[model samples]
Target: MPATENVHVWGDARPLYTYTRYIQNHFGERVQKLAVDAGLSCPHRTQGRLAGGCTYCNNNAFNPSYCTPSKTIRQQLQEGITFHANRYRRANRYLAYFQAYTNTYAGVDKLRALFEEALQCDGVSGIIIATRPDCLPESVVNYLSELAQRTYLFVELGAESSHDITLERIRRGHNARSTEEAVHVLRSAGIPLGLHLIWGLPDETPEMMLQTLHWAAGLDIQTLKFHQLQILRGADLAEAWQHTPEAFQLFGLDDYLEFLVPIVEHLRPDVAIERICAEAPPKYLLAPNWGLIRNDEILRRFEKMLLARNTWQGRCWRGEF
Candidate 1:
């Protein structure tokens, strides 16, 4: 657990420790992340390894149209900058976000070349690499450690759930223990770490979801991203839901807000809350439609609820729940 002394001090109007605040504090200015596809494949979806991907994952749902592996890294970065220019006009600096598949699922030399390519791009300040925990072998971790020493780097692991049973149900090749071990390795290397969790998974009750948050809080990490499981059209979960919809506990927007408020209260104050919900393109999304509401709107509503209840992040971290 994080130190509790002065845990309640937010120093801002936001009720939770948001990633935006963390970025402003670290970079001294607003920094935008330009998502780039590295044309990488996951170990779980490879021919020799586990063939099927995660049941709830449809990568196309979250990826922007400009982000594709077909383009060069520099092309993607330039296009991404132009893509977000209007919305984040103040963002002069940017981070090259390798978000598609397992970014580190390659040889150290290849990974280094790709990352350096992005670093060489104009206006790019740093890099954020997202990959599966089991893919971070010692060789990759060592390379990332060296990279972190010179530039801003964040390694986000997709530890979708902390329960081994749920992990298996989703066909996640590795168990929760892989995430724990990866966290330890990354922390030892002095790498800033982030863990991603899916709130609504098959057979995961509200209590189980909270247990995953508690488990993640104990890890040596600097960030957390909570994504409500979305049943996308082409995902394995969608097929299953079609067969038996009652088995899945998909959250309506109101139920999600009610469930998420307590999660914010229980989250460790020092950990930056990167995201609270997932927004898939409506064309790809199958169930639990929130009706054209964007992520920013969802966040606004959540913060309002937090203030109305007079609660904030880490309110229950010291066993106050």
Candidate 2:
């Protein structure tokens, strides 16, 4: 039995707490996120590190065409705003989403310069930085803390999975402990925090995925993003899958939807879910081809399933009941 006061339903009848509601409540209106590529490289992908970076990662697969590192941050933001404007007409204010690679891999001075450049753009309200837990040194954390005080800021750490064994298999350089420490550090600094998790991975079972969500629910995070593992053409995981398909348990669309209901039900009510699925361009996608089905459609079907089952986020949360 969850506390009645803790239950929240968005205006659109969303059963779970959603990023849209969170944004509307915070900004008093719709605010779109314009993805920007800051031209920073991940430490894991750098020379002399892990050979192929994350086995499942191919940033280009998910990145918007407008988000190219060659373009200036301001230019990218402007283009993104233009691109999103047609779809999200209600969004006048925009948040610069540093989404491509590890955004905070640079020194404080350079990071500040790029962040400020986005803030200087027209209609830009805030910035969301995506980075790895291992990349956040004390210096970077302090700078992020300082930045948060001035304007709206959110730091999203790529936690991927809470299972160290799965993490090792994926070649995600940092362990689960690194994610915990990063969450604690960011929360202590009074920075709003978000976490990114991959649902289906090489050797993760549904129970294992639930354990990761349980771990996340206990964290001091404001938001979470869930990306179903997609086998992309150029990713190392694709090569591995080609050689040994039995090693992975990738989700078909309906199966993913079925799996997500319990996941949403177990999530803490306070944590806004930013995304529940990932959709890469068909050209880069190699497997689990749910043809022409978009993220919004998945969300719609998920919500319908939740309604049919008479459940919402935190329905099965141990902390709540």
Candidate 3:
């Protein structure tokens, strides 16, 4: 017999979706751009050489040329929209995305000013903040709750893995427990959350990766993104990889799918799966050239695997093992 879809108490995949891309498909005629840069750095990295940033971090590695600090927060937003508007000509709405560094790593009052400035923008529709789990303060949570009540708001946490050892190996400076606690605290506020994870990390097996997905499924997050670990152009990881390449196990195209198939099955039915992978620019990528493949090709293979097994997302999560 075929398995039937179940309705979830937390409002599973069908009725309400958390992704901005998914929402744009339904309501808006044109998608808007939001850009925010508050001068924030990870606490681990702020001390300079002690903890340094994550082994795989270079803020400029992925930073768009459009994102510049000379401009105020509001000026950055206008510039981002202008760049997109010239091409689309019809998109009028925007969401202010606080992307660079750790957006929440500041005083509550300063954070409030940055957020409020974006909300006041004429075409701005909502806000999406990208920050590490450890950086989100109580004041930030309360401030965001009020904003969620008034306008669309969500937070993205860099909870990259469930493996504590991997966390230490990467010098993440925060544990899986910290991520869980942060998620729990913020969930009570009712703003949607987006969790970021990387598929290929050093010392993690397929089982470990699935465990991360299962853990994520238990959360109240609205969306999730899976990124393949890219050894970027200027990242500290690249230097390490040169000396001890065996420390990393970068996946070929097929090996990554092997890791992902069960992840799709085990992830919560309610979580909106956003990007399956990040496209690392060739010039900046020190390894893992498989990112050159398109997202659609990967999705097609994933869907094929699901159909072949006659299983879909949330299937394993909802059933007996």
Candidate 4:
């Protein structure tokens, strides 16, 4: 198919449902997303569940330098707009990404204040609040649902994995049940839902990870991001892996691409794939250096592979769960 032609199921030229294409199709314009650190701490980290955070967590691995919790929301958004200005010149509109820590862990009133502050920022058309499933109380969901009616809003929940054993191994402090309940509540309230999942975790086999894709295919999620776990410096998982190296099997670049191809094939056609891989700066990364490859390059290669094999998302999908 030509670039001008749209794939019927995906509604785009891409082999898979892409977030960029989805945004373009919906907004009819380029929409840039800016990450903001709202200074909110996770209950699992601050409330005595985990001393540091999830075993594999190192916020420095992904957080932008411009995004610091110490900065006020207005200052952060200004810096973010400036930072992304040169890169995304075509994007006049932006979505404030409440990315660092659990964004919805606070009380509903406080959460509203923070969200409203971001929404009020110049050029910001919507807000994407990244949070844990266990943190979305009924009140928060109700409030967010009401807010969604007024502006573009999204709630991104970190599911990490669909398996309880993997959740326990990562010290996630929540189970798949909590994720399901949260998804149910958000979907019931007509909120757009996004989920994040990590493919490589300690003791998680390829089969186990694919099973997670099968599990997520049944949900009301509109978007999904698949991150291959990157062991970062100063993270608990790094120390543990060093001590018991055999306990985990890390994926090299090719290995990960080959491993992920089938999983994508098994995914539902409607779930937009926001990110197929996660990249960290070389300074913070500890293993599996795939070079400083940009996401576009990786995605181009991924789609080429799919085309070469004559396969696409949902090619192997089965509704039976």
Query: Residue 264 of model 3: what lDDT?
Result: 73
Query: For each candidate, what is the lDDT?
Result: 0.89, 0.89, 0.76, 0.87
Q: Write the per-residue lDDT of candidate 2 for residues 1-321, one digit (tens) a residue.
A: 434444454434568888989998799998899899999978889855789799988989978989898999999998897898777675779999999889999999999999999999999999999999999989999999999999999999999899999999899998999999999999999999999999998779999999999999899999999989999999998998899888778899899999998898888888899999998998999887889988988898888998888788877776742
User: Between candidates 3 and 4, which one is better according to TM-score?
Assistant: 4
lDDT of 4 by residue, 15-89 (tens): 788898778877888899999999897888898876776999888778998999899888998998888876767
Could you arrange the candidates by lDDT from highest to lowest? 2, 1, 4, 3
Better of 1 and 3 by lDDT: 1
Quote the positional error of residue 168 for candidate 3 in Å.
0.8
lDDT tens digits by residue: candidate 1, 1-321: 222433445445578988888898799888999999999978788855555788887888888999998999999999999899866675789999999889999999999999999999988999999999999888999999999999999999999989999999999888999999999999999899899999989889999999999999888889999878889999888999999999888999999999998788788788899999999888999988899999989999999998888788887886422
Where in model 1 is the C-alpha error above 4 Å?
1-10, 319-321
Please, what are the lDDT tens digits per residue for candidate 3 over residues 112-225?
888898889878888889888988778888888888898888788999998899999888888999988888888888877889998888888888888888887777777898
| TM-score (all chains, Cα) for each model | 0.95, 0.96, 0.86, 0.95
RMSD list, candidates in order: 2.6, 1.9, 3.8, 2.2
